[model samples]
Target chain A: MNSTIARLTATGLLRGWRGLLLALLPFVMLALALLVRMAFGIDPEITSGLLDTFNLDTVVPLIALIVGTGAIATEIDDGAIVYLLTKPVARGRIIVTKLLVAITVTLLFAAVPTLIAAIVVTGAAGTVTWAYTVAATVSGIVYCAVFLLLGVLSRRAVIIGLMYVMLWEMLVTGLVDGARALSIQHWGQSIAAELAPDAITASLSLPVATTLAVLVTGMAAWFATQRLRSLTLAGDS
Target chain B: MTSIHIDRVSKWFGHVVAVNDVSMTIGPGITGLLGPNGAGKTTLLSMMAGFAAPSAGTVTLDGDPTWRNEQIYRHIGMVPEREAMYDFLTGAKFVLANAELHGLSDPGAAAKAAIDTVDMQAAADRPIATYSKGMRQRMKMAAALVHRPSVLLLDEPFNGMDPRQRMHLMELLRQMGSDGRTVLFSSHILEEVEQLASHIEVMVAGRHAASGDFRAIRRLMTDRPHRYLLRSDDDRRLAAALVSDDSVVSVEVDSEEEALHVQTSDFGRFTVRLPRLAADHGIRLYDVTPADESLESVFGYLVQS
Candidate 1:
C-alpha cells in the first residue's frame, strides 16, 4: 500500500477522457431515473427494476472493467510501468496499491452514483439504496481486481471484459439458467438479496457468494503481483 | 566503487536469442554498449537493470543477484528507451512522483535538484505531451536521477536530441562518471560512443564481439582485410607488380570486368605501394576504389572474426 503508487494510479485512471466517458454511465442512469419518475408517475416498483437491472447489474461491472484495466494496462502497453517498476518498492505492494486505487475509482464512479440513482428511483423503500450500494461495493472490488489481473494478462482486456459481461453474463446466462451460477452478476445479485430478498434473485447462498467473491478477487490480485514480478519490458525489436 | 557483473548471461525469447552467452563487468565510470540495430543492446541493458531475468547465469551488483531483487533498485537508476512516462502529468509532478516512489525523506528538494540537474526547471511545470523529443528525454533523465542511485543505465539516451542538448547531456554524464558513479549507456553510433565512452563493449548480431578501450576497438574495426578494385591500362602487368608486394595478399586479374581485384592484409602498406608499383610497371590507373566500407560490414567482420 504505497501512497505514491496509489496516487499515481488514481490520477492516471481519472484524468483521461476515457475516465470521463466511463464515469458518465451512472449519472446518465440517475438522470434517466429522475425522468422516469416524472414521466411514469413515481412508481417505486418500476424504479426498483431500473436500479436492479441497470445500475447494479450494468454499471458496477462495466465501470470496474474500464477503471480496473485502465489502472495498469495502459502503463503496460506503453511501457510506462517501467517508471514505477524500476523502484525498490515490493511488487506485491505495488499491485495491492494499484488494485486498491482501481477499486476506489470503480466505487466512486459506480457505487456512489448507483446510491444516488436508487434514492431518486426507489425513494429509500426497504433500504433499497443501501442494498444496491452494498451490491455495487462488493461487486466493484471483485470486478476491479479480476479485471486488473486481466489487464496484466492481455492487452485486449477491455474486449475480453466486455464479452464476458455481455455474452457470458447477459446472453449465455440469460439463455441457460444454470450458467447464472458462474456469473459475477449472480454474486452481486446474491449480495443484493440480503438487503432486499424480494428485489433480486440469488443463485447461491450469501455465505458462498461472499466467499467466492473474496477468494477470486484476492487470488486475482495475488496472481497479478506474481505476473508483474516476472514482467518483461520487451524492447522495440 | 559500484560494479555490475553479468556472468555468462543469455536471454532468449521464443526462438530468437537476443543476448548470447556473454559476460562482462561494468565498473564505476562511463562504459558504452555499442551495437547496430537489433544487436541486443536494449535486451542487455534490460537484464543489467533487473527488468528481465537472464535465461542462463546471472547479473549482479557487488555480490547480490539483480533478478527478483527489489533491493537492487536502491543502487541503480534506469532510463528506458521508450518515451512513455505518464504524459498527462507536469514534468515537476512526474519527477516528484518518482522521488516519492524512491521513499526520499525530502522528495521536493530531490525532485527540484533532479529537474535542475537535467536543466529542465524552466519547462518543469509544462505537461510532458507538449515537450519536444529532446525535452522529454531530459525529463526522463530527471525522473531516473531523482533517486540519485549509484549505477545509472540509459538505453539510447542521445536518440533524437539536438546538438546542444546532446552536448549538455554528454557533459552531465561525464561529470557523473568522474564522480565515480557507474554509468552505462547504449548507442549504435560509433562517433557517439567514441566521444563519450572511454570504454566500449561492442555487440554484433547479439554476440559480444569486442570489449576494452575504444582505441583498440577502433583498430580492430579498421584492421579488417581491405578489398580494392583497380582498372589499369595493363591489368596483368599491375597484378604481376602488386602480387610482388608483401602487403598484397592476393591479386586476381578479372578479364571479364577488365580490372584487378586485390585483397590486402596491410591496408596502409598497400595504399602506399599501389600507386608506386603501378607507376613502376608503367600501368596508368583508371580507377582505384576500396569496397565494403559500410559500418555494418565492419560489424559483420567483427562478428565473424
Candidate 2:
C-alpha cells in the first residue's frame, strides 16, 4: 500500500465536517450509555440490548458507510483523483490503501466507542462488550469494503449506501427470515452470538458468516481495484 | 526524444462523437492544440494522457499502449483542465506527496525543485485553498513536473492566469521544448497559440481540420470566404462598385436594412479595398463590420477544405 495515498485519504476524511459527524456518533453513544447507567443502574440485559440494537445495528454500519464512501468519493467528485491516477503506482495498491483508511476510521469511530459505551452501561467486564466490539469491527471491514467500491463505481455512493444499510440490512433483514443470510448486520450478529450466546440472535452459523464476510470483503476490494484501473476522467463536456 | 502517437483515434460518448478518426504524431517540441470551445480538444488530450481510452484506435507513447499501462506514467505527466485539487494541504505538501507517489528516492528535494521551477516557492507553505486561480494552476504544474517525465500534456493550461503568469508559463514551456521534451497544450485563442507553439494542430467539430507551421495554418484561417456588412450613404452605389473588385465574391443590397452584404474571397485585399472603393464612388461608409468571423465559422471552413 502506498503511504502517500493513505496519508492524503486519511487527512481528507478527518478534516471536513465528515470527521465531526463521525466523532459525534461516538459521543452520542457515550452520553446515552451514561444516562442509562445512572437511571437504570448496571443492568447486563439492558447493556446487551443497547449495544446490539443501538451500536451494532445502527452506529457501526452508518460510520462505515460515511467513512468508506467519504474516503474516495470526495476525491472522485472533485476530480482530485487525477493526480493519483496518472502515476506509475499500481491501481490495486491505491484501492487497498484507501480501503485500509476507511476500515481504520470505522473501527476508531464505531468499535472503540461501542467498547467504551458497553463498559459504561454494564459497570463490569464481561463477554458482551468484547463480543459486540469484535462483531462491530468485523462488520465494519465488510461495510467499508462494500462502500468503498460503491464510491469508486458511482457518484451517488452515499445515497446508495444509506439505502442499503437502512432498507436492506436493517428493515428487510429484521423482518424477513431468509434475508438475514445476505445481510451484513446478521453476519456481525452471528459472530456476536457465538461469543455471547444469550446476547444476540444468529441466522447463519459462525463458519458460514465468517466465510461470507471474508469473501465479500475480498471481492469488493478486488472489484474496486479493477474498476479503478479503467476509470475515465471525463472532461467538462 | 519522446513522441505520443495517436493512430486513427476516435472517442464517442453514447451518440455524440468527441474525437473522430483523427491520426497525428506529436513529436518532440511545443505543439499547440487550437480549437474553438467544445471542439473536442479536451477529449483528444484525455486519450493521449491515458485518462480515457479511444473507442476505435490506440494512443501509444514510444510504441507502448497508454491504456491500462501504469508503467507508461513513468514517462508521462499530465495537468488536467479541472481546477479541483487537495485544498487542505499546503502547496509544498501537495507537490511533495505527488513526488512520493512517483516513488522518487529524494521526494523532498524533487518537490522543492518543482516548486522552484514553477516560481511558486514564495507561497509553497500556503494552503492551496487560499491561492488564486493562477496560483492553483501553477501548483498543478509543479505537481505534474515533479517527476520530470519526458512527455507533458496540459489541457487549457492558461485559462485563469494573468498576463505575467501567462508569460512565465509560456517561457517555461518554451524552455522545456528546447530541452527536447515533448510539450503539448490546448488553447482556444489563436494569438495564444501563435505566440507559443512552433507547431500547430487545428480541430473543429471533432475532426482534425489542419496541421503544420503556425503561419500556414493562420493563412488558411484568414483566407476563407469572409462576409461583411457594410452600411454606406449610397448602398446601391457601394454594392455596384464593390462587385467590380477582383477580391469581391458577391455584393447584395439589403433594401430593408439599407446596407450592402458583401462576401469576399480575399480577406486582406477586400479589407484594404472596401474604404477606397467607397471613397472613389463618392459614398460615405458608416460602418464596415466583418460578419461570419466567429471561431466556429473559421474552423468550419477548414473542415470543408
TM-score of each: 0.95, 0.98
Candidate 1 Cα outliers beyond 4 Å, as residue runs: B230-240, B253-260, B275-289
The TM-score that candidate 1 achieves is 0.95
DockQ of 2: 0.82
Instruction: Name the 10 consecutive residues with the lowest summed lDDT in model 1 chain A.
Output: A120-129
lDDT of 2 by residue, B84-113 (tens): 999999999999999999999999999999
Query: Model 1, residue A76: what's the lDDT?
Result: 96
DockQ of each: 0.75, 0.82
Model 2 chain B worst lDDT run, 10 consecutive residues = B270-279
lDDT of 2 by residue, A196-216 (tens): 887777889999999999999
Can you give the lDDT of residue A83 in candidate 2? 89
For model 1 chain B, the run of ten residues with the poorest summed lDDT: B290-299
Model 1 has an lDDT value of 0.88
